[model samples]
Target: MGAPDFEFRADLLDQSNEIVLVLDPDTGEIVYGNATAMDVLGYDEEDLLGTSITTVTGFDDVESWAEHLPQDEDADHRGENEFVRSDGERIPVEASVSRTTRDGEDYIVVLVRDITERKERESELRRQKERFEQLFETAGTIMVVLDEEGFIERINDRGSKRLGYERGELVGEHWFETVVPDDVEPEVQSIFEGITTGERGGVDGHTNYVETKDGTRRFVQWHNTPIHEGDEVVGILSSGIDITERKRNEDELERYESFVKSAKDVILSIDDDGFFSYVSPASNSVLGYDPDDLRGTSALDYVHPEEKSEAESGLRSTVDGDGDDVTREFRFQRSDGTWIWVEAICTGCRGGGSDDVGIAILRDITERKEYERELAHQRDALEVLNEVVRHDIRNQLQLVTAYAGMLEGDLEGENQEYAATIRESGQNAIEVTRTARDLAATMIADERVASISLRHAVESPLEQVRSAYSDAVFVVDGAIPDVAVAADEMLESVFRNLLQNAVQHNDKAVPRVEISATVDDVATVHVADNGPGVREDMKDDVFGAGETGLKSDSTGLGLYLVNTLVDRYGGTVHVRDNDPDGAIFDIELPLAE
Candidate 1:
């Protein structure tokens, strides 16, 4: 204690710019002041040394400061308050007051700093932030700021207006509570959880009803984003876009799709990868496979072995985008090992995010195919029978005519009546044989299958009928557009037989024949006649091999041959009454590829 630690005292105040003052704690009197303390307060060292610290820079409220100060000498303390300077100016300051002992002398050390500029800048920043909040509150779209807990911390003016609520009503409430419909709560919650967990960044295309304060609901599409602070999520930001009209349209589309899927016809979609992406449940009853089993499986796998090559070629054409529509008649394998005949129509185009997809629809034609086979067999048998009948009947009829000629020359009186009867009977027999040969040849040749144009096939036979019946007016109505037909020969036979029967069997004063063609998903040929309609009792027998009208003397095989040929061509033949009392025959045939 020889130098009284003068050097230690200098070192203590030399390193820091803070104003340091030593005071007598018990009397609140100033005992010493540092160089910085004098400069900061505009005071001289001698002026502060003798005066009490409170007298030089008095606390704004001495009674309050005195009461807040710690009473115990053993504890340290800190506080903030204003002080009046020598000039009588008020300044906010933070004072750290600590009780200390130096050389066994009890005293208090006060460290102080002026915070006037800092406080001014803080107040300016708060004003600017308030301005920004005011601008956000006046926007048009519903804007919401949410904390990490999904609570609505702030909402814009438009949001409040649309929701029919005041701004305060929304703050502190869950953002989802006002927007999410009760029916969609589960879905909205799941999406929210996903966003919160960082599983999804944003979600669009969700349409839900939002309930307003007025108890009305409106459809809206929400766009959401996760708010991140550095690497951590702090909250979410959401914008609502009203889409009530769009939602209604979407609902209508879904309803239409549902109806199509439930239709009796099988509706399906095949991808460019040659796989069935969508197959209706009706496929189970039609194709012998569960709809689930067919999905992602190649549709070509079900094609019959014999028809696989053709089906594959058609599929390739579709995949290459070379054909818009390609149709083929093939057999499809059933679960029972047997094959069912089918006519498939394939339409090629881009699908499923790629251009390599193909789609096809198949219709079962097993019954039509079976009928065709039976008709072909019957036609062949009838041809052989006709050849024998023509040979024997012609020979017998020629002998009877020759004998009738000789008897006419040798007879007189009563014998003449017998000769006349024999001669007429022989002539009738010859005519019957001729008609039978013509009908048999038509049936046999018509059984073979070949592709031809519908217009040409139907018009050619109609031309012949028009030529044969000069007195009967023949009018071909409706345009017979070009179409592909598998069995041209048989269909031609059917058309010719129908036209001839109409002309020959009609009792109308002016016999008229109408032949028309209609092309659609399938091609149809309609042949009608202005004739006394077929008797109801004879309609069923008209298609029989040997059935003929009670009034007609012809070999009654015309309608029978028409039905046979129609069936051989994988088509149907049905009878109907024409408008003005006549027979109408309707035939439907598959289109050519």
Candidate 2:
């Protein structure tokens, strides 16, 4: 063995911490074995010699491992493998395998170190790293890790999503230079530097705006903690909240404060228990009381006793988020021992982390209240006058109709013609009273309008007028298709007036009138009369009260009623010269879908 010219003692190999073995290069045999190898593998020195290396590891092919052995003298063998101990226990190991020559014969030297404990440590470390990454990815708040130079080292999933970028795109980018808008970067640079360098000491509640990838910016507030290695801060770990909407609301609140500060209206907030929490500055000017006096007091204390219960219920509903914004009008006690009416728009202010239950905007309407009271008093007087006129005049007209019927039974011949005339006059007076009452009702009460057939309205009025004017003939023509008009029960009376006006103004002994209707996108009803026609200058003015034709004998109130009712019902009425010297009225009404 060439005297084994070694620097250390030959027995030192047996004393080594690692397993040392010398084997034949071509055969599956161990030429030599160390004492430590014998002790660990549960084998004697004689038993190890000529033992195949395959029995030490689970693998069946020992030649495959030998193929990886070092071929050059300068290169040292290095690898990881498994081995079996003397008791058949498998163990992991880091190994060195190489071929050498001793006594001009080829041999293999193998060095093995047990790696079971190291592998257990490595596996545990991998599990811990995976757990940390999972938490980082799943965190809701925007989190980022910044290097000492204030560049992004790692960003969590939320940070990347909020900034509108892919996961890996924001990494390695300078936080200040890229994330902040150009107009604000100069001012924020020193502040960011102070945070990173520990000069600022704290970053909690530090607000800044970040420009996103889409060029829109967001307001972000951050809380940061230094990442330390021993005593030195090498980086920073920051968590942030997106506060754009909150900042916008703050700005709006400031603007609102500025506005209501000068306005006559007051805005107030009440807690869940109905105690006033905030009151606007205008409270003093508008209510004759200071705002501070209202705070910490029950919100309904100043309201009239009649309205307090209702206001309390509204406040509770608002706090529970049970309904929409509340609104009410109530009498509020003034500083001068009197009550004034105020209109309030109350909204729920207690949901999604809000602490206040109710917020209200109030405005004084004392003048409007007084005006409404006066109008009500006047309407009562007008209603009494209308009732007296309708009752007394209609009763007097009925008496005339009864007396004319009595005269008709007691007369004969040309004297019968006189009784007939008397009866007609009495009937005319009764109808006139009815029409007068209808006109008054049109002015007093709202139109009870709905969708009605335009053609039907015209025919109904013609029947009533035909009975009143037997000398005249009323003709209704055209396809008379179904067309709807916004009208009420009095709609027929509107046409009745038009037909009476045509006949009563006629100079002809036998007056001829024609009415036609057509349907399209809108319905048009035309009523024409053969009479001394209205003057051209008075065509539009004919719709006005007291307007009459040059030959008209009496009051133009009838046409005025027709125009008023038609216009109120969202229809239009106009007059034109009829064919062959007469007056034609065109009534255009809306066509229902």
Candidate 3:
């Protein structure tokens, strides 16, 4: 080429957007570089001119680059490789090489293009694929990708392990044929078809059973989405979790709810504000109110006016979660506005939620309360009768005995005997009245148990009986043990009645009685009398109501009261025939703790 022609071509190449380089084929040196080449390579013309091609290209030498070039001079050679910049940074580039003859001289022409953005795009695609694979395999739930024809394209590690299969065993297998049971295959296939045909988008929370390799089935909850290529649906991606255990828990909860609904007691829950949060269906039968009607209403509204304060206080402690279980009885209004007694047991829970709630179980106690009321009335009436006998009857009997005694001294012969009989009968009647008074006092007493000294209990009654029966002899076998027993003021009456019975019923002229007591785990007292021995069959019936021992005309209230009081103190009393003659009354009482 002429110099003008070479200058024109060189100037034209410099103006081109491409990075152009002219090289010496044999030397592998850059003969010329365009302006674009200098700017992209980060170098000036002086820094690049005459530089060896190996400095910029990855090739080691001229012969190495020649081997990759096209052998035909007319053909162009293309390559994708990196170029080292002046600043020592390497960037990817595309290169084209061709050999041409100018004025019979061989020369090489090379064109280069920067491809950093394109290479970055490729790298980003690889990174996104890796991230997707990591998420798909490591997910907790089963994930699967299926083709439009229902073939398994991909199954995650979790899905394969859950189905008892190796990593790639499920790939390329028909999903329904391999995993779905025969009974539900047709139905599942229909849904899959809808997804692929665009008739339905996908499934959300659809449940079905999947058979494993061992033929055991597991119920799964599925959520699926369609995978689209352009405007056409190509496949489906599904996620599933085993819901068998959750279903069983739900069934148990349902059964428990049914039981609560049919229970006879009213069950309810209360919030922190003392209002009812939930009420069981049994409220209708138990409290004469509908469950819905009771909900959201204050529980204290139905309580009796006198009991509202106690009810409110209990509610506060329970909802605050600071109190133990509480059981209390109070009057509650029925649906008809009449009051009925109810017993409520309430409990609380801590850390349950924002407002820790309380639960109450209420039962009707109206029948028991009514029975208690009737007993109170009967006791009051008996108390009035007891006062009448204690004063009126005893005073009248005393006057009759005094008048008969006066008559006895004045009369003679058979008249004197008649006066003595009248005096004795009046005295016996007076003693009977005292026994009756003791019985009445025992029956009406509340809180009837206390710790009593055995020694005092026996000594006081012994002295009284000895003074009353001057003709009878009373002796203590040994000193009475000074032990505390579980008894009350009525305890003295027990020994008094026994001592009186021993003397009054004696057939001997001089009645001899011996009292003794021993203490171990309990206090046992024995009262032995030297009298006609009681029959074995009558011993048990002696304490029965109206069944007197040795005296049929007398009321057996004294002996009966002895049995009742002993029982109240957690003790027992029994009569047995003494050795040779008379009877022994044995009383065993618990020791006071």
Candidate 4:
């Protein structure tokens, strides 16, 4: 019997890896330990067997442990306690203290489990939850929780700050009191009733206005979801985002779109597939197509066949993402099958995704195009007639005048006088023919860039004036600069006509013609004469074709040709009163580089 009891005690020690202390029921003292306990406390089993557990545990709660000790010396008290390790570190432990009879002596048996790692994990989880709650409370959006009956249960810091209320003051208040205006109460009540009765879906994304504590209105977009307890609705969780500025911008954009649709000019957009996506209401008057008819139809289909290739090329360029601006004129077939000219200006438009689109504005130019065509035809006809008269007819007239002069030189006496009269008549005819040829030449020649020196161009007409009026005083004022001009022959014709008109119209005994040239950035020639100035009533008509100041049979083409040629060179010619009471003709021409 004694050997069996000793073996049982050894087996109990081997089964536990903890420090087992069998203490006296009325006193605290250590009794035994396993090998693991002795190794953990940095002591040999023999040395720890008789030592108190408090010496290794370093616990100051000895009295509490004594009170919870087994009263009948047979029960156990389960508790968690702390112990100091051999390295002087505190460790959390769970202990079960029970009374046992060993050799008829009352003692305690204690079981312990280290729980330090478990406690550390619990602390880390607590800190993480606190961080998330802080983020939620400080978010920019207004967050609120409502009971199933739409009563406000809780509001975050942002919500209370926006509503001008203390965090605690808003709780238990009715949600609709703050959000729904009195005028819109019926509609709002219907919405909440639907939510509570489960008729309409919970307001996930609804935009409405809310009133602040100060009675000012605010626009908010609510995103609410039902907080469910099992299958039944318990409450609603809502997050509101302030969108007042965004709503205002949307309203302005809607007004702008309306204005664009009602504009007089056609505004349109085409997708990458070349189909019209948008067309303004003006399409009815401009393109002969209804606005709806243009949608889904290729805009290029209505273009004239001759212009289709160019229009397609531009469209393809836009689809390929080319950056060039597109501007082209094309003929579009109207509803009546008649073609009307349209000028289209297109720009490439790119959206968030897909291929590039094309935005275009089209304008009708049918009347302008028709006028241009008629003007071109008239110009071509006039050019051909002028060419024939100047080149062919004038050569024959020059030959007739030359033969008459030779015949007059051959004859003598009475026959010579008669031949002299014939020669004079022929000469007069030649002068008329020359003037006609010059006028025709002026009308036919291309008015493109033709540079001529100013001095050389003016000498020919000045010599003619000196020869014709030998007694008249003709002064070429100072040394004229060599001015390069685009229309040299036209300038010569202009000066010649003015000088002749000055000499012929003057009733003065000594007719004086002063020709002066002045040049700065632009070239100007002034021809002043001691002749009567143009009449006020005739001034406006002086530049008109076939208008003349002289009552005599002057063709009046001289001043008209001068005005026409000056305009062709982008120059100006006007008559002004001379400084000393004479007629002054001022001609301005651009200086050629």
Best by TM-score: 3
Q: In model 1, which runs have C-alpha deviations exceeding 4 angstroms?
A: 1-260, 263-273, 351-356, 385-392, 434-593
lDDT of each: 0.75, 0.79, 0.87, 0.76
Give each model a TM-score.
0.43, 0.56, 0.58, 0.54
Question: How far out, in Å, is residue 294 in model 1?
Answer: 3.0
Comparing candidate 1 with candidate 2, which one achieves the higher TM-score? 2
Candidate ordering by lDDT (highest first): 3, 2, 4, 1
> Candidate 1 versus the native: TM-score?
0.43
lDDT of 3 by residue, 1-593 (tens): 21113565778888887788877777877878889899988888888988878888867877897786665588998989999899989989999999877778777888999988888999998898898788789988889999999999999988998998985789999999899999988878888999999999989998888999899898889998999999999999999998878877887999989878888889888887888888998888778899899999999999999988888778778877776997778999988888989999999865546453788999999999999999899899879979988999999999999999999999999999999999988988887898888888877888557888989999998898898789899999989999899989889999998898888778888999999999888899999999997787888788887876564346777788889889999999988989789999999999998
> What are the C-alpha RMSDs, in order, of all predicted structures?
13.3, 12.6, 11.7, 14.6
**Local distance difference test, candidate 1:** 0.75
Q: Give one digit per residue, the lDDT tens place, for model 4 in 1-593.
A: 11113355767776666755556555466656666566656677677766656766675556655776777655768877787666777777778888877677667777776777877887787887797577559878999888878789888989888888888888999888865678766766776666666666678668788888888777788877776777777777788998888988998989979878878778888887988888899899988889898888998889998999998887787666687788878998877788999988888888757443878888999898999898677678767766665677667766776776788788888888887767655554444455555666666566686887888777789898789777789988986778798775666777777777787667678989998889997888888888777877777788887775543345676677778778888888888887666788888888886
Clash list (residue pairs), candidate 2: 41-86, 56-84
Question: In every candidate, how many clashes are there?
Answer: 4, 2, 0, 0
Candidates 1 and 2 compared: the better one by lDDT is: 2
Worst 10 residues of 4 by lDDT: 1-10
Worst 10 residues of 1 by lDDT: 1-10
